[model samples]
Target: MNTDVLVVGAGPTGLALGIDLARRGVDALVVEKADRLFPGSRGKGIQPRTMEVFDDLGVLDAILAVGGTYPVGMVWQDGERVGEHRMFDPAEPTEDSPYNAPWMVPQWRTQEVLFARLVELGGRVAFGREVVGFERADQEADGVTVRFAAGPDVRARYVVAADGGRSVVRRTLGIGMTGETVDPNPLLVADTRITGLDRDNWHIFPPRGEHAGYLSICPLAGTEDFQVVAQFPEGTRVDLSAEAIRAVVAARSHLAPESVTEVRWASDFRPRAALADRFRSGRVFLAGDAAHVHSPAGGQGLNTSVQDAYNLGWKLGAVLRGGAPAALLGTYEEERRPVAGQMLGISTGVHRGEVRRGEATRQLGLGYRESSLTEETRTAPAGLCAGDRAPDGKLAGVRLFDAFRGPHWTLVAVGVEAPELPESVRVVTGDEQPSYGKGLFLVRPDGYVGWAGEDTSRLADYLDRGVTR
Candidate 1:
């Protein structure tokens, strides 16, 4: 095998996994067909859930340095002031969690940050190298054979297909994406700089009857520009004519036609919500866009992809380091498939709900009930409210000596006797003896709280499962 792990496509998902593998001193190869990193901006908003993933990689602060913080959250009905929802603030951190706010950054910038981290960790992404083909010998000891555009066949013990929606790896393995492909009609998405429009908040408008139009406008970081996305009614041709776009903007925002000027960049494409039938086949695993594709309804496409990478990254590293079993890697599919399915259904529903009011928590409140690590917390009421990512609060003023200080297994103790601090466990306590309640909790390496029961003794059995010796 040319490498222990071969990751196809060097997008955010692949790079994130590569960085974690490199940090663990594992031999991993990240291959991309594109000659260079992405230059275009696709997804713009980075939710708090995704920030926690980056935090574990020790790149969250650097990402924040390049990204802008937008305290303003989602809006209802055409950017109307009414019915506004605010993102959780991070100013106050508790023992329960750490990241409480989302940051705004372009998808391209995120890839750049991950790539830099990968290089620093001694992993390099070979660009212009595509996995034209692959062949698996067996289920467990499968050897992935890949043919570069002009290079010779390269084989690896495992291959991860992060090759976007139309994944060649998935197709080669005969994996079908099973889901509804709604609203096939063309939609306009632009990453241009809007001069007259200036607002930190997300601007959205439901399409009105007859004159149908939708709008999403927010500021881009490190510049005086804003990313504007406007979706016209089905059958409306998205053209280069400035007059055409201005008319759509004016109609939606009720702004003067003359107020709109300059189109930095724009494109037209249809959005769909789809997920692969299976996340793994033989030794090849599918992830990110390759595993699932969905409408940018809640601005979830990019964030979901990054989150996918985060989930698989550590598992791959642990397995390669002989610290975990091969079955541990298989859990990647079992854990993430349902998540992608839920996200697809919820996000698409959120987009459609824009036209019609419906129950909206499915899109925003995702709690992980399928994970074995979260089984104890599943019955707990404090953190396991829904199937969304777990929320994080600050740790008042406790000090740890590392950069991303909370990577170790966190064992939070409450009224019950606290568990003995294992070598790899980080203990979060109060002024005196450890005290925990609704605000107190423990955090796993992947940022999920393994044990959330008020009883701290539960952690001993929880961590014993696989967290500690």
Candidate 2:
């Protein structure tokens, strides 16, 4: 095999997966059809849960440096300031959740950061290479052969389709996507430099009459740019040219055409939500937009896609390097499919005004309680349970996150006698931790509690399920 894993498309999902695999010393390759990274601020809002994922991936510091909190929305009418609008409900940071609010970073900047990190980790992305077709190995234990449009065929133990909604690998594998259009009206989104707008507020212009639609201009944090989103009636051609965008801005808001200095990037799309019928097909797996597509209203698309990569990365590492059985990989689809479905509903709801961007949109409460991988052995569990996110705290003069930072399972003994764990697993012992009352928590590499109990009788068996001695 040319590599252990062949990740298609160099978007956020592919780059994130590449970074995760590279840190584990896995032989992986990322291929992109585009000549360069994405250039637009398409997915600008990063939710709080995704912030935690970024922390583990070692890019949280950079993300925080390049992004800022979402600005308060300012309403305008007849070229005058009308009132102030709040984009999200208020929330404060807690011990369990450090990032409390949504962060604003242009999607282009996020990709650039992930790409640089991937390169730093010794991972490579081959550009201008598109996958035309692929064939599975004749035997279940063998690898798959992938045919590219511009290069020789390559073989890999597994392939992941991180391509966008119009995924060629998914289509080639005959996987169907089921979804409905969230909004029939076309929306034009672009990144531009405007002179008349202030960077402190997200400017909003309500619809003037039956003929005119609403327009919003938000300052992209940490940069001299603004993201313009304008709605159009159904059946409109929705021109994306510079002149068309300037005309829209002038007609809908107080900004004159001359105030729009330059159009850096632009695109138009109809808001829609979709999910693939299946996430895995034999040796090929679907992730990011290939697995599910969400409307941009709630900012769940990119965050969910990044978590998908995070979930699959550790499992792939375990099976490839830790002597785990291949069936362990099936848990990825089982755990993430439901999450994609739930997030899709939330995105669609936020787009239709049926749900507010509140706790659900933050995604901090998401868990894998129903997965077969979770083992809640205790009859009465306190504080945390199997499948819940292991909260960060100080234990025995060491930070729990610091202990869980690297690519290894952490057996956290809080207010309990520690066990003699295998060398493959890292152990953290303490007399007490506030977030975790008094129990043994086995934190998975992905930062989820895989097993929790009052004793160590079942710990070894759980380790034998995946970890090698």
Candidate 3:
């Protein structure tokens, strides 16, 4: 089989990318080694920035329907209730930033939501198709032949290794990863059902002895299951059996062995933060956990991964389906790697209790200010700038997000003159916007401000220079 792009792995990253590509009429294939989507509740916190990406992807309503706001954390020690703990700092919604907090949705359910959206767009994901390796005559070649473990090799002009941290494609391409172990202790995470715990708050059990570590049980929003996290000292093997889980709950919290009624899915991993040395290897590009692995603290891993896909999907669509230069793909690494590095530090700091899950964890502040694609032509601007996220607001009876929705470019002319843009670049003219002050903003398909200026002369030049070709 042949395709324009072959996306490995059907996790959230691959599925989200496939959905974006499919909607743009790009011929893409998503394949998975496993027979079904991931069944765990890992990476459950959906940051506000990611929620914006979902809104553009046509899955925000469904995501909101299947998820709820995070509950307050209730602490316990020696079987006695203690004070409440807020996992994230509170922020009020504003006219520009509506989503102020993380939404609690099980990772598995998030994947299901994405998969359903992809299927709705007629995207295909083949299961049981494992990529063992890939081949190309030249390093910078036209196509790559990806060999599978159980099926015919597929050819693609570009390949994305969203296969995850232990990415077979990345390793096969000999890309080295640079990172360190964030925590020496091993941790266990499981989706379980408990009997005695109230679903109103996240139940926390502090370590009582030197040998024991912290344990927390958080009620999974929109479901009966509670996600259980337990830490063990270094060099100790974790038992994933139901009995071990029950015993752990009985020993740490006041809950008895019978409280853990069901252990649906469980996994163990040591906390670590790693990043691939390079995101692209010739025809293949690394995204999601394939590009960077986080400590899972402050819930940055999956959110970063989804944004990685969000950033790449539009660029790929531009090159393959919208007559853009292939060099447009180069900016993906330039824009995402630094963001990945920053998120890694945030995750590690949060893991070590040195950082708070506040504005940083929300991820709304992240942007590509230094990217080569960004052109800050304004001498002195206020509020939003080039390489910043285009804020959502209503102006002249038009919602900015409503205009920015779908796979298209948006030119927000707020209290400024207009430009003669191509038919592809949709223009939203407004007299005033508090977030945008007297400038022409060229918003990329991924919602980042690509160009900003006081005049329309440079706007056309930026768009004509292979940006909107």
| Candidate 2 weakest ten by summed lDDT | 135-144
Model 2, position 461, has a per-residue lDDT of 81
- Write down the lDDT that model 3 would get: 0.93
- Model 1: weakest 10-residue lDDT segment is 355-364
What is the per-residue lDDT of model 2 for residues 162-234, given as tens digits with 9 covering 90 to 100?
Answer: 9999999999889999999999999999999999888999999999899677999999998999999999999
Model 3 stretches astray by more than 4 angstroms: none
Question: In model 3, where is the ten-residue run with the lowest total lDDT?
Answer: 133-142
Return the clash pairs for model 3, or none: none
- Using TM-score as the measure, what is the rank order of every candidate, best first? 3, 2, 1
Q: Which stretches of candidate 2 lie over 4 Å from their true place?
A: 137-141, 467-469
Go through the candidates in order and give the C-alpha RMSD of each one to the true structure.
Answer: 5.1, 1.3, 0.8
lDDT of each: 0.68, 0.91, 0.93
> What lDDT does candidate 2 reach at residue 316?
93
Report the C-alpha lDDT of model 1 over 296-397, residue by residue, as the tens digit.
766677778877887777777666773666677777887888888877876687667542212232123445655765645435464343223444433335
Ranking by lDDT: 3, 2, 1
